[model samples]
Target: MSSSESQDETHLTPSALGTKAHWDSLYALELTNHSSNPSDIGTVWFSDSDCESRIYQYLTSDDLSLSPTTTFLDVGTGNGHLLFSLLEDGDFEGDGMVGVDYSEGSVELAKNIAEQTPNAEGVKFIRLDIIKSSTELDFFGSRIAEEGGFDVILDKGTFDAISLSDEMLDDGSGRRIYEVYPEKVAKWLKPEGGIMLITSCNWTEDELVKKMTSSNSGLEKMGRVKYPEFTFGGKKGSTVCTVAFRRKA
Candidate 1:
């Protein structure tokens, strides 16, 4: 592909939401809000689309058969709500759930919420940048390290936020960080039967699948979560989409 076509294929205009500073500030404010009112856990991204409920259903459905013992990792786990919901509502064990984010404020906010949430004592919140240090899965602790990798990995809005960034990798590839995200994170999924589900509003279903299943990503599309469709200019699409992928053996 030509340079212009390559740029068009990979680029998304940078936005404030794409920066660490933005999340740090927002989570700090959210932390304050939680201190004042424990019920205020913070924003639930894509809640209008019922994203969390659909994801829970997909995981618990007969097709996946993910049990309570199944290990989970939530990328960019803001407020740790998704894991908490899975634990509380879906009866997934808290001990097998872990949430990671780069922002300290996000980690702190999640930890605080976990303390207040029932049966959440086992859920862990860690501060780590996946794109920069995704290779360091050992830091995720003994169970995950010994088990090889998590059974289910989730990315809700994290990839979309990453795609909005203009930051380039330091490897001299001249590619944005988001371009390398799939490969970076895919390694954390078990080579056998592990699944990663991602929800995005910025990209269509086809675009999300292409990014995850790119030549270097070592992942393949397994399934998708259906959403209400709308027709605009004779084209049918949804405001948001969720797709599942499994690491290629």
Candidate 2:
């Protein structure tokens, strides 16, 4: 669980990414709401109705599926809503899940919620920024490697957080996201692990694959197979999410 975003950059905005202020404001509002409710941040734009239902479909399927004892990472875990959604799911059967976020308030709320929630076993929430190439990524990777690389890593809105403005993205961050992210995920993931990324960019599944082909040497170098995209709610067309999955290489 890692989040990467700085607060000072006001000029640059990738459409789907969250600024530090955005998160700060979100937590400021959520502070009054408390984290004990079934769903703390119910109306977050990131978890739009379409995306919300779509995420459940992903979780029930092989995207985040795990045994009774598999470790998981939920990136950009805002208010622990997505993670809580999984916890509330009647069909979930995983072990040792953790969420990471940048907002201190959100992180504290999430930690409190996970600690107090019923049936939320083996779940922990931490506060850390994944942007700026911080050690949080290394910290997660090392922690996983020390025990076991996460069997599954799920990114609900993180990359969308990275789907940035042309100028801010031009700072080598977007390309680095495309380059280092996949490899980094693989490094701390099991050989038979899974990575699921859900995004709302205009890029379709094939367009994303093509972009990744050029940006990520590790993805190209490793002979990993791409699973076909899964349509949510039996909808045929893309549903604001271009989810890509690959076995750890």
Candidate 3:
């Protein structure tokens, strides 16, 4: 559940990585572009859709066999690109696409983007702070349980953002967000083969699998998606990777 904790400025994004304000600021900039050309909603983290597209391929692959009605949830969904990508892919006629983020601006931006995309009518963009544990979360959790839980949950750098939070580095009590995320997310997913897919640049595939499985009691290592390779000083690895874990009964 520990990592080298990247201390390099190269990994630091211009906007603060792990805070509500950081995402708010990022969408504020992209909101301008979205207004000018509704189709130009900016992509953060990866410059291209390669990582996201690969994730869709993996889900639809023979292993997962994700269907149109699979009940998808995108945690910390920024601008809802991943959900939209899933919807737009050929042969994916899914419903109940949900995207939640802590930032109001981020949710608003996602809503705006969804409005422009024809197939995104069923998508739900909710402003919820998944990092917080409170009565409010309890209320939300009840509603999630009412819906019978999601079949698949996607985390595109959301856990990485949580890991980089100042609270995670602070005293032990402040570690609640990082510690509770996997548990809370697991609860929101339908058990007995429900999947949690995470795409991260901050953590390697091994680190991510360890973190999720260790923190969440019932998660089992399913598999991971391979991205383009990067070589630094002869050692070869990818700058980013997407990993999937399944919830067991």
Highest TM-score scorer: 1
Q: Write the per-residue lDDT of candidate 3 for residues 34-117, one digit (tens) a residue.
A: 888887887655646388878878888886776777777898888888888888765464356778888887898899988878
User: Clash totals for all models, in order?
Assistant: 0, 8, 1
Question: lDDT scores for all predictions?
Answer: 0.88, 0.54, 0.74
The C-alpha RMSD in Å for every predicted model, in order, reads 1.9, 7.4, 4.5
Candidate 1 residues lying further than 4 Å off, grouped into runs, are 1-8
lDDT of 1 by residue, 1-249 (tens): 632244436567899989999999999999999999999989999999999988988988999988778999999999899898888775588998999999999999999989988899999899889888846568888888998999999999999999988898887767788887888888888889999999999988888888788647799999999888999999999999999999988
**Residue 153 accuracy (lDDT) in model 3:** 90
Clashing residue pairs found in predicted model 2: 3-129, 3-130, 4-130, 4-131, 13-165, 14-164, 14-165, 17-161
lDDT of 1 at 206: 89
What is the overall TM-score of model 3 with all chains considered together?
A: 0.83
Model 3 stretches with alpha carbons more than 4 Å out:
1-15, 133-147, 168-176, 231-234
Q: Give the runs in model 2 whose Cα sits over 4 Å from its true position.
A: 1-17, 35-65, 89-95, 134-138, 141-143, 165-180, 184-186, 211-213, 217-236
Q: Cα miss at 55, model 2 (Å)?
A: 4.0
How close is every model to the real structure, measured as TM-score?
0.95, 0.67, 0.83
